[model samples]
Target chain A: MARKAGSDGSKTAEAIRAAGLRLIFEHGYEGMSLRDLAQIVGIQPGSLYNHITTKQALLFDFLVEHMTRLTEALDAALAGIESPLARLDTFIEFHLRYHLTRRMEVFVNNSELRSLEPQNRAVVTGLRRDYERRLEQILAEGTRSGALNVPDVTIATFAIIAQLTGVVGWYDPKGRLGEDEIIAIHRQLVVGGLLPIP
Target chain B: MARKAGSDGSKTAEAIRAAGLRLIFEHGYEGMSLRDLAQIVGIQPGSLYNHITTKQALLFDFLVEHMTRLTEALDAALAGIESPLARLDTFIEFHLRYHLTRRMEVFVNNSELRSLEPQNRAVVTGLRRDYERRLEQILAEGTRSGALNVPDVTIATFAIIAQLTGVVGWYDPKGRLGEDEIIAIHRQLVVGGLLPIP
Candidate 1:
C-alpha cells in the first residue's frame, strides 16, 4: 500500500507539472490561479500543496527542467561530432528539432521570465547562459580553426540561436514542408552564414 | 469650455493608451485588469469607460496601433533604396533600430498574440504578414537579379526577420557594442548568408 501511494504521489506531481505548463501557456503566469490549476488537474485546491509547494516554485521547476533537458539533449546530439563545422551543423539541427515539438514549453519559458522571483530568475538565467555557452564555444572553436569566419562569436551565437529557434513560432506539422526540409533550409542559412566566403 | 473639454479628453485617452501598454507589458492581457489600468492612470473605474470601451478593445487598439506604426515605418525606411541588397540591408537595420528602442511594445506584441480574440488575432496576423511580405519581395527581387542566393524566399524571410528582431531581446544601450556596431554585425550574418558562395 505504501509503495502504491508513493507511485500515485509521483504521478500526481507529474500531472501537476503538465497541467501547470498548459495553464501558464494559455494564460500568462500571472494570469493563472492555483484554483484554475487544481481544477484542471482534477485535484482539490488543498491537494495541490501535496504535489507542489507554490505556483512560483512550479514555474521555476518548469523552466529549470526545460533548460536542463535542452542542454543535456544538445550534449547527446553533439557527442560524436568532431569538426567545428559539423558540431555547428548538429547544434542548429538539434535546436530546431528539439524546439519544434515543444512549442508550449518554449512559449512559456520565453514569456514567463518576468514572473519569476529574482532569485529564481537568476537560476534560470544561469541555466540559459550555460546553454548559450555551448553554442558560443562551438562558434569560437570554428573561428579559431579557420574553418568559419564569424565576425564575433558572441553575436553569431545569439543570432544563430534566435534564427533557429524562430521555427517554433511558425512551424506547422500539417504544413507543406516536412520537418527535415525545414531543418535543411535553416542549416543552409546558418551554416552558409558562418562559412568563409569561398 | 467645450474646446478645453475636448483637449482634456484627448490627453486622457493618450494617457490611457500609454498606461495600458505598460500594464500589458508587465502583466499579460488576461492578467491586467481595468481597475488596475484606471488606478495607474489616476482615474475612477467609471472614467475608464470614457477613454476605452472594453479591455478587449484596448488590447486590440494597442496591437493595431503597433502593427500600423511598424509597417509604416518600414515603408518609410525602405523608400528610395533601389537595389534589392540595399533594401534588405535597410530592412535589417531598420527592424533592429525600431525594435531596440521599443522593447516593451515589441515584447507585448509578440507575447500577447495568444491573448487576442480569434478575429483580432487574424487581423494582427494579417498585419504581420504584410510586414513579412516586404522582406519576401526583397528576397525574391534579389533572387531574380541573381545578386543574392536565397534558398527559399519564404524561409529566408522568417529566418532573417527572427534574427534581426532578436536583438531587441538582449540589446543594451549601455553595453559595449553601440547600436550601429550591433547592426553591422547582424548585417554581416544576414547579408553574408545570402551572398552566393565565391
Candidate 2:
C-alpha cells in the first residue's frame, strides 16, 4: 500500500521478491525470516512493510505473478491457432519453456504452495488451475478435431504438466542439452504418443 | 538400533519404526514429535530413546525402510522380464500403486527430504537415486534392444517418472476410476508412446 518512490518502488519490490523467493526455496517458508529478506535487500526491515504487508503477502504476490505470467504466456502462445495438433504442440512447448525460464519461482508455486494459508492457497491454486485448464482445453480440442487420441483429457492435462515441470528438478543451464533440446524431447514424448494414428 | 519386544528386541524396534512411519506421514516430520510417536505405540518418549536416539534418527529409519520397500517392489515388478518394453510397463504400474498406498509418505519424501541434515539427506537421496537408476535402466535396455523408440533415453526417463509420480497429488481412493484403470492409463501413456509404431 505504501507504493513510494514511483518506479523505484516497483524496481525495489521486484528485487525484494526475488531474494525472498530464493530464501523460501532453500529454507521452507517457516524457516525464512523477514529480517533475512530485508538484509538481503539492503533496506530497513520496517521499509519492507511499505512494499508488502507481511512475508506471507510477499509469497502470495510471487505465486500470483507467477501464475499470471503463465496464463499470459500460454494465451500468447496459442493465439490465433486453428489446428488442434498445432495447438497441442504450442501448449506443451509453452508450458516447458515457462517452467525453464521461471525455474525457482515456478518450482515454489508447484511445491511450496500448500504451505500458504487457506485463503492465499486458494488464490494461488485457482490461478494454477486456470493454467491447467488451458491444457485441458487444448486436449479437448485436439480430440474433438481428430488431431489427437487420448483416453481422458483431465488425466492427460496433469500427466503432461507433471512431465514437463520435472525439468526444474534436473535442468541445469550449464548442462550439455539446451532448453530447446529438452523441450524438443518433451514435445516428442507428448505429441508423438498423443497424435492420432495415421 | 532398536530390537524386538517381549524378550525379542528386534520386534520392538520394528514396531516402533512402523509407528513412526504412520505418524510422520500423517503429520510432517517437523510437526510430529518423539512423544507423539511413542504415545501412538503405547510407550513413553524415554522408551523411544532406548529404541532410537532422536526424532531425526527415527525419520531416517522410516525413510530408509520406505525407500527400500519402493525399490524392492519396483525391482520385483521388473524381474524376469526380458523385453525392455514389458519391463517399462511393469515399472510404471509399480510406481502408480506405490504412490497410492503410501501417498502421504511419498509426498513427504518429495517435499521434506531437503529438510534432513547433510548426512541424512545424503542417505535418503541415495535411496531415491537408486530408484531413479531403475528408470534409467529401463530406458537404456529399451534403447539397446531396439524395442522402444525415443529421442533421448535420459529425458524420456525423467519425463515418464514425473508424469507417473505426479499422480499422488490428485489421485483419490473414492475417485471414479479404480486402481486397475489408472494403471492402465499409465501403461498406455508410457507403453503407447515408447513402443515402436506398428
Candidate 3:
C-alpha cells in the first residue's frame, strides 16, 4: 500500500515516482533494484519506506496512477461531444496528444505488464479494459447511428486504438512532421477506415 | 559470436536458443541471466559457451533471426502479386498470419529491442527499417498508381502496420473470430483506410 504523500512528503514522493519510472523504463522491472531506486531518489535505503512500501507497490502505484489519470483525462476530453463521429475524432486527437510526449509511460505500460503481481495486474488490466470499453462504446454508438462503417465494432475499436498508440514508437517532434500534420494524417486514416464505403 | 553448430552440437544449440527466447520473453532480456538460461536448458553454465559467447550475442541472434525471417517471408509472400492493392492485401495477411501464432516473438521483438548492444541494435533496427521500407514502398506505389488515397505514404504505412500487428495481443485460436473473418476485418480496415474517398 502507498502511504499518501502529505505536505512534507509530497515532493519526495513525486521525485521517487519519477526516478522509479526511469529505472523501470531502462531496466525491466525485475532488473531494477530497490537499492538503485533509493540511491536515485537521494534517500537512504531504509528511509525509502517513507513513501513507497515495496518495489511492487511502487510499480503498482505507477501503473494505476497512469491508467487512472489517462481514463479521467479521456473522459474529460469527451465530456461534451454528443455525436459519435465527433467523439471519435476527438478520441484520435486526444489519444495521440496525450501519448506523444509520454514515451516512457507507454513503454513501461506495454513491456512490464508481465512484471506486475497478479492482483495488481488485474487492477491495471481492468482500468485498461475500461479505457478500451470507452472506445468500444463510441464505435458501437457510431455504428448504431449509421455514421460509421464498422464491420465489427470490437475489432475496429482495438485496431484503431492500436494504430493510434503506435505513434509513440517512432514519432519525433524534431523530425519531419509536426504534430498537426501527424494528427491530420491519422485522422484521415482512422476516419476514412470507419466511414461508409461509397 | 555464435559458433557454427556442427551436427553433434546443433541440437544443443537449438535448445539453447529456444530456452533463451522463453527466458527473455518472460523476464525480459535485461532480466534474464545466462546462468538461469543454462539451467533451463539442462546444461552446465560453462557449456553455454559452446553455442554463444555472451548473453548479448544470444539477444542479438534472437532479434536478428526474428527480423530476418520476417523480412524474407514478407518478400516471398509479395513476390508474385503484381497489383499494388493485391500486394498490400497480401502483405497484411502475411504479416498477421506470420505473427498471430508467434505471440512470444512479437512481444520479445518489440519489448527487448532496448536490451540489444548498440551495434547489434543498429543491425536489428536496420533490418526492421528494411521491413518498414517495404511497406512504405507499397504505399508509395499504391498512391502513385491512383489505387490508394493515402494522404502520407509513410504515415499510412506505419499506421497500417501498427494496426495489423496489434492482432497478436488479443487474438486466440479458440476465440469467436476465425482467421478468415479476422483477416477480412483487417483487410477492410487497411484497404479501406488506403482507398480514395468516394
Candidate 4:
C-alpha cells in the first residue's frame, strides 16, 4: 500500500512485491497486471509505480528471491558437513522443504522466468547456475570419496534438479504424507542415483 | 498455409498448430497469438480462424498433443515387460529422451499447461494421472514382489518424475552427452533409488 514517502517507502515497496508474487504465482505472469497488484496492496496506481520500477522488476524479484534465499541457506547447511553424501542429502531435503512451503514461488521460478528482460533473465539464470555449480562440486567430492558413483557430475547435478523442480507442480501439503516423509523419500531417491558402493 | 476443404483443411489445421507450438514453446502461452501463428505459417489471418475455433483451443492442443502420443508409446513400451524395475527404467529413459528430442512438445507438456480452460485442463491432467497410475502400479508390483524397496510407492512416483522432467529444461543435443547416454545415466540414477536391496 502507498504510504508516507521518506522512511515508509521501503515498506510499501516490500508489500507490493509480496502481493505481486502471490498474484503472479496464482494467475501467472500473463494474468496479473500492475493495477491488480496496486488494488491488492491498497495503493494508488501511481504510488505503486514509485515502489517498483516496472512490472518486470516485481516479477524478476519474485522469481529469484526463493532461489536466492534457499541457496544461501544451502550454503550455510553445507558449510561444515564434510561428508559429500551427507551434503547431497542435506541439499535435496532443503530443496524439498523449500518447494513444499513456497510452492508458488517455485512455480514462478519455473514458469515466469522467460517474461524477464534479457539482462534480468541472465541474472536469474546465473543464480541457478551457481546452485548447480555447488551441487556439481559436492557430487564431484562424493565421486572422489567413494561415496557416490555417477558419470559426469555436472550433468547429474542438472538431472537431479529437474527431478526435484517438479515438486512445485504437484506437491500437496495437506496430503496423506507430511513434509518430512516426502523429504525422506526424496533423499532415498536421490541417494539411490548417486551414492557409491561400500 | 490455408488449403482446400476436407483432407487439405485438416492439413491447414496441422500447420496452424505447428506454428502455434513453435511460437508458444519458444515464447510462452501468453507470448504467442493467432496473428503471429498465421504470419509464421504464411497464411491469411482470417483463414487461420477457419481451422481453429479460438486461440485457447490451440493452446489446449499444444498441451495435449505430445502427452497423448507419449501415453500411447508408454503403454506400448511397458506392455509384456515382466520385470517391474525394467518397466520403470523404460518409463524413465523414454520420458527423458522424449522431452530431450521434442523440446517444443516438452515445453508444451511441462509448462504451458495452465493455459487450458477447466474441462480441457481436466482432460490433459487426467491423461497425466493415467500415466502416473501405471507407474505406481509398477512400483507397487515391484514392492509386492520384493523387487523394489520403498516405504511408499505413490510419493516415490512423483519424485522419480520430477527428476525426469528436469532433464528437458537443461539438456542440449550438442552437449557432451547424447540422448541415449543421458538415458543410460538416468537409468543408473533411477535404478539406484528404486531397485530392491542388491
By TM-score, the candidates rank as: 1, 3, 4, 2
Flag the better candidate by lDDT, 1 or 2: 1
Per TM-score, the best of the predicted structures is 1
> On a 0 to 100 scale, what is the lDDT of residue A97 in model 2?
77
Q: What is the TM-score of each candidate against the true structure?
A: 0.97, 0.87, 0.96, 0.91
Top lDDT: which candidate number? 1
lDDT of 4 by residue, B106-164 (tens): 66677756677889989999988988888889889989989888767887787777777
Residue A83, candidate 4: Cα error in Å is: 1.5
Residue range A1-198, candidate 4, lDDT tens digits: 675657577777778878888887656676678897898888888888677888887887766776688789889878888888888888898777766777667777877776789999999999989888888998998888888897778778887887776676777778787888877887888887776654
TM-score of chain A of 1: 0.96
How would you encode candidate 1's per-residue C-alpha lDDT over B1-198 as one tens digit per residue?
A: 357747878988999999999988898888989899899889999999988999989999899999999999999999999999999999988999998889889889989999889999999999999999999999999999999999889988999988988887788889989988998899889988888766
Model 2 regions more than 4 Å off: A1-4, B1-48
What DockQ does model 1 achieve?
0.75
After superposing all C-alphas onto the true structure, candidate 1 shows an RMSD in angstroms of 2.0
If you assessed candidate 4 against the hidden native complex, which CAPRI class would it receive? medium
Model 1 lDDT tens row, A73-133: 9999999899998998899889998998899998898899999999999999999999999
Candidate rank order under lDDT: 1, 3, 2, 4
What clash pairs does model 4 have?
A: A147-A196, A148-A196, A162-B166, A163-B162, A163-B163
True contacts kept of 1: 0.60
DockQ of each: 0.75, 0.48, 0.76, 0.61
Q: Which ranges of candidate 4 are over 4 A from the true structure?
A: A1-8, B1-7
Among residues 3 or more apart in sequence or in different chains, the pairs in candidate 3 whose N, CA or C atoms overlap within 3 Å are none
